[model samples]
Target: MFSKACEYAIRSLIYVTEKSKNGERVSVTDISTAVESPFAFTGKTLQKLVKQDIISSAKGPNGGFYITEEQAKANRLADVVSLIDGNAVFQGCGLGLKICKENQPCPLHQNFKEIRKQLKKMLQSTTVAELAESQATQKTFLNNINRN
Candidate 1:
């Protein structure tokens, strides 16, 4: 239910965070391959994240994108979602109506409202560090490829 850019942003961030936690920085090419995103698109998304201070970058030898422990703890999935997709996911009408409100609800408004509330809570509660840990421990997989 997220935009393509948002999906890549989340994946790329988690990959970077995982590697960073292990004291390694990741290159754009490596991140794109790891996350199965286009290199240019991943780079652009990384730039946006860096600009917003959600991630960090260095240059020259021994330089790439990484997240600090403080940043990892401070950021939540909701922050990335809001940064890339705004609050539309939390506030927009489910039926894509230009104007759907409580009084003038869409067909799926009430149901979607509840779903969105739950989604918002989940995203807000999930930290980047937690996601990275899950990935690092192989508790979760980012790509669809079967490692087995």
Candidate 2:
């Protein structure tokens, strides 16, 4: 339900968070490779995250993206979603109608309302730190794994 950029942002942030726990900074190239996103697109998405202060960066030879302990614990997936995609997912019509609203509901509007509410709650409740820990411990995987 998220845009490609948003997807990349979430994955890259989680990757950065995982590395940050070990006190490492991650280059955009590394993040792109790990998340399987296009290099330039990942770089751009990362810049947006940096601009929004969802993550931090440096500018020297050793400069890269890293998150603070406070940020990892405080930032929610909803923040990234709001920054990259706005509240559209939470506030927009389920069927992509430009004018759908409560009074003039789309066919799927009523059915989708509860779903959207739940999604909003999940995103708001989930911290980047939790996802990073999940990845670090192999409890979850963000990128596809090739069994072959």
Candidate 3:
């Protein structure tokens, strides 16, 4: 249900967080490849994240993207979704209606409303560090080919 940019942002964040645990910075190219996203798209998404302070970056030979401990701990998946996609996820009509609401429900409104509520809850409850730790422990794989 996420846009390609949002998908890449989530993947990049998880990957970067895993790397950042070791005090390492990851490049755009690395993030793109790891997340299976195009380099340019990944770069743009990273820039947005950087601008939003959802992630941080540096410049120079050793410069790249890395998330601070505070950032990882404080930020949630919901924050990334909102930054990249706004409230569209929670506000949009399920069947593409311009104005679907409880009083004037669409065909799939009730089901979709429940789904959106669950999604929002999941996003709010999930932290970047939690996902990063799952990846770092090899419980989850970022790409088709397992790196760990």
Q: What TM-score, over all chains together, does every model reach? A: 0.97, 0.95, 0.96
90-127, model 1: which lDDT tens digit per residue?
99999899999989999999999999999999999999
For residues 1-148, could you state the per-residue lDDT of candidate 2 as single tens digits? 9999999999999999999998899999899999999999999999998898889999899899999999899999999999999999999898999988889999999999989999999999999999999898888888767222
How many residue pairs clash (N, CA or C atoms closer than 3 angstroms) in each of the candidate models, in the order given? Answer: 0, 0, 0
Q: Of the pair 1 and 3, which is ahead by TM-score?
A: 1
Worst 10 residues of 3 by lDDT: 139-148
Candidate 3's TM-score reads 0.96
Give the true-structure RMSD of model 2.
1.5
lDDT for 105 (candidate 2) = 96
Candidate 3, residue 108: the lDDT equals 96
**Residue 147, candidate 3: how far off, in angstroms?**
6.9
